[model samples]
Target: MGSVVEHKRTDKRTGKTVTQYRAHIRRVGFGSRSKVFATKREALDWIRNNESDNALTKRASAGGKTLASLIEDFIAAGVCQYASQAHLAYWCDQLGNKLVSEITHGDINGALLSLRTRGGRRFTPDGIKPSGKPLTPATINRYAAALSAVFNFAQAHGVIDAHPMKGGKVKKLKEGPGRQRILTPEEETRLLETARAARWDGMYLFVLMLLTTAARKSEVLNLRWRDLDLGRGIAVLGKTKNGAARALPLVAEVRKGLAELSKVRPINSDFVFYDPKQPGRPKNVDTAWQFVRERAGLNDSDDPVHRVVLHTTRHTGVTKIIRNGANLAQAALISGHKTLAMLKRYEHLAADDVLQLAEHALGKVGTGSSKG
Candidate 1:
């Protein structure tokens, strides 16, 4: 039921007279708030629309949740089983402040766009480059996913009728260039020699792991000694990105590298790669790796590989495997990517070469029919 009441009142200081109509509407879950109008007809119209919006808000509130409340609940549940707390915290910070009723698809799009605008940045601990760097599209995609998950979770929990994010589209930015810079045979030898000559103990082994397994630097650092099954010739990766446990076989050189690491490995820490200076701290070899890159004499001011960091090794490995005739599925599995499409991006061949290979495989070798 709804009612419109007319009233006359006087202003306090100015003492001006006023006549107004106040619409009183009954909400299913929330109490009424007075809406003022100039006339009875306008007040009635106001009540009609207010009633509809109030009903939606009431239903959402009935389950003891609001949009904002649901997001906090999702974060508090600690549902990101495989994600680092810092990662989850980042998403929480991004979306936690908005009231559910106030959020729109535009807000979600803006957040992703902001991430794209900033390249990628790393923490220095010394407060040097506080902004770090702009983030990659892949990284931005992860944040978008997390945001989507939160909104979806809210809808499922009855906090909202539909996820604003589910039907919405985000303009995906382009993926960054692959870190794969295939080392020439001579360059590969020189890089290894340089790593061997490094003052660091595990530098040689780190280089070997990169060349053999194509494991990302972070993934390699996260590896535990127990993850290795030397007899089976496989290294079980229990913790990598994408929340899947994968097994990587040891190449001949990888096997020898692990054997060497076993001799000098510390019995206390569980890590296969640990730092000596930061004892018990798992090796974060990026800084040491930069030094190795410089010593190799391959560095230049304009080279993309200069900013390549250590993940380039993983990229290099994947490229070499594909070049050596490994199947896409095999490379995807070894690289721990969720899709075959991602593996295709790692192969650095020219567009013509791709067409040529497709034609040859499809029995249309020299013909342009493959493109068609």
Candidate 2:
């Protein structure tokens, strides 16, 4: 059983009185449902759906398990523990009490669409700001993947007969080539100088380490004194996004910086990079990084067109690795990328570099290879 309530409120944008509808549903043992809608019809419609789902659950608890219980089991399984926990939580918050076996493709798609449109920073100083940027295909795909993992796990454990996301019922968006914003030598110089100007010792070294090893931000931030084998010029990374401990070779520039820091190191803290404000913990570079990025003129757009940011250092480093004569396989090994396809995606070719490759294919003729 459910009821809809109508209330009048002033619109933030229009500055006019408007009617808002709030629907409430109360079900024994399954808990209560409530949602606000712009129209009474919409509110009533949602109430009807809740009544239907609740009725179905009472009939037999759809395959003897609810989505809410599945989430608890899935969390115990720890498949998407950190990297994608929030994405999974978003789905669970909405659909948790529903039966996994009864959850349809439409259910998942509708939630994704609502998330894209309705997720906004409301009541800001500038009033309601529509998320200026629409979600990218890559981002949407990641959300799909997180949900897919949960359903797959549920099916594998015999909780469901089949998963809706499987067999192309819900298709992912066709993503474009990954972002590639390799820095020029001048830009690199300016960025390093700007980091120094920011006056965070960790920022300068971290920037150098990123350019040198092509390590992810979290990878470098987790580094400790014992993690470095400076004499051998390699770093052993115990914790990584992929859950595999691997080694990243230290380039001369990074080695030089690390060597300088090692002499003045504090024995009290084992962390290689520390916040001067807190010596025991890993350095908090966010504020210093913001300053450095602005000073270095970094763009913060995820427009999928192209932009440079701290993470762009990985793209830049990988491009330089391949340009400096590392083959695709070698580049993958160095950057710890699992596949050649991923390695190639990180290798952004400059227009001039492509022209040179064309020139090389055509063969070098007179006086250092130029035609007048």
Candidate 3:
């Protein structure tokens, strides 16, 4: 139901009264928006149009919103803004012309199949070419997630009645274990030497932080100078992957490196690992990482598990922290993981070479259990 009210106002200079009509309505989950008009008839017309318009708009928009329109909304809202929105182009070609509301789980599966076969591209310095590697199930799930998010956003904004994802029905790609490469002490020494030899700003410090703290690349990169408590030897990471705040221990090596880097660090910038060129933002470490890994001769592995990348430092760090005697709860706090299940995934990645520690523990238990 809608109601109209005539608002009366008196002129300051002239002894005259002004009348205005305002109409307001509430449409349950569809939400509320109102319009005011000079004439009562105009307000009544707007109320009539808006009330009926919501219903008609829902039908027309749901029926006529093509996949291309969804992508447009996705970009506008910065859903997949990273990769310059090119990663989603394959989906645009497959489902761009189809209506969003009518798109089915079968359609999504079909698109995933197309990607796995020959529906995507690979870019080179010269131009675009057919992608050699087929899309992984994990990658396909990511695309499905992005698409589901588009629908979810629509539903949240009252553009659609409900999202079409319907839980995990549309997202059905089983993924195997994630990457699991731990760097040996020898490799660590060599990699650090290589990074220092290359002479890039923040490279050495960033590497040391990941190796020492088991912090993600994003968490390390997103750190501000203010986040550090130099006196207390702790770094507060507020923008962690789990979206919670945690304090990262600043080890002797990381603390020493930070002290040296702080001398040359930009005082104007807040970031601890900020780019010299763009002091406000984190330095782009990908190119430097690839270069250093290639220089150290560690980039030829076929399996992602064997790949010695920047994130390998985090894995190695976590495993080392646990091996040196931190429990799962301590590891989770250091790594900023929200759950033990996530730690279990890491445990699966890392080989258990500490069986001797378990034996030693059993020996202690047996000694303690002895009856005199």
Candidate 4:
């Protein structure tokens, strides 16, 4: 049982009316009632609401979870199954401090804006500094996407009422046009002959794999004999950037390179490209590559043609396939890109292709003649 009573009194110091509520709280023994409020309405409301023990318990116990708890739950669950564990740690660092209820759309926007302002540095172990460059739209969009995944999980579990990133759109910046760089037949012959004559151990095979199979440096370097099916002309990539496994078709030159590498592979190691000095580790050609570049008179790092890092081999492969008149869909599949948009970024027509088009359009014989 509860009783609500109010008394109007004057403060001796201030000489002002002080309205207070005194209630007879049953659970406690104090005179006849335990009084504790400055207003009669507030006292009555407390008396009515506190009458149910279950209601008090429900109010106190509900909504008790915090942002940190939710992030831990996400990490422990299957979220890190395919994605890098470091990425999970990064998300926790960025968004884990705020209370779940306190996070708003504006907070997410501020985080993304911060990323754009620090463009050059990756979200690595080292911190990102503000590059003072304008934010790229693609980068901003990726941040929005990563945030959406976390918030979507939060919403599904009732940690958030609705995802802050839900229905939010990011404006993408116009991408700069790609400059195509494809070697001509003469250049290709020269490059291949130079590779053969250079007589560097496995350098010939590495170049052949780049020009023929179009395998990325990481993929080619990490290639294991178990993943290769020479009979089927397939190289199975166990983990790819798209978070899926893919297979790359092997070409004749790629097969020849693999055959050569097979004779040189160590007995204990299964890596198709293992270095003898490193034993188990993939051969690192970084320093040796610079040496070769200098010897080949291709040391100008600033020149796009000479800027041919190890990755350029894969680029050459894609350009070759595209210049051979492969459709966008086929090229995308071959490259393991999730969409045609990414394939378009790698597409380069050879200079010979442009010359061929010009000859066809202008009619080579008539264009050469003055009709005197």
Q: Residue-wise lDDT of candidate 2 within 1-372, one digit each (tens)?
A: 899888999988999999899898776665455678999999988887768864546534445577778877888877653336667777878788888767889998898787677643323445556666666777778888888888888878766656888867888889977776678899899889998877776688899889889888878887898999999999998756665678999988889989999999887888888767678988867667778978887755655557776788888888888888788898877787766876766545644576777676765665575652
lDDT for each residue of candidate 1 in 1-372, tens digit (9 for 90 to 100):
688889999977889998999888765556444667888899988777766774646654544444456656776875543444444466556665666645668877876776677565555646435355566666777776676677666766656555667643555556667454556667678788999988887888878887788887777777788899988888998766776779877888878878877887776777888877665788767667777888886564444534445666777778777777788898887888888987877666423357667655776545766543
- Per TM-score, the best of the predicted structures is 3
lDDT of 2 at 293: 78
Give the Å shift of residue 178 in candidate 3: 2.4
Candidate 3, residue 58: Cα displacement in angstroms equals 5.3
Report every candidate's CA lDDT: 0.70, 0.77, 0.75, 0.64
The list of candidate 4 runs beyond 4 A from truth reads 1-93, 99-103, 122-162, 169-173, 178-204, 243-245, 260-271, 274-310, 346-355, 358-372
Model 4 scores a TM of 0.57
| lDDT of candidate 4 over 1-372, digit per residue (tens) | 788777888998999999887876454321122446887777888778766666434333323455556767766765523334444455567776776656767776676666666554334235645444564565456555555666667777755555656554434445444334544466555556666665457776666676676767767777888989888898998887676788988888788778777877788888887777776888766655565555555444654344656566667778778888887787767776778887766644454577777766665565566431
Q: What is the lDDT of residue 135 in candidate 2?
A: 67
Q: What is the lDDT of residue 327 in candidate 3?
A: 80
TM-score of each: 0.67, 0.69, 0.71, 0.57
How would you encode candidate 3's per-residue C-alpha lDDT over 1-372 as one tens digit per residue?
677989999877897998998887666544444567799999888778767855645656565778788778777875332223555676788889987767777888787777667644655656787766676776677777667767777777665655567856565678867777888888888788778866586687778788888888877888888899888999997656555789999998888888887888777788888888888888878778877788877787967557787889988888887777778898888888789877886665445755665665565664655531
Which pairs of residues clash in candidate 4, taking residues 3 or more apart in a chain or in different chains? none
Model 2 global lDDT (CA atoms, 0 to 1): 0.77
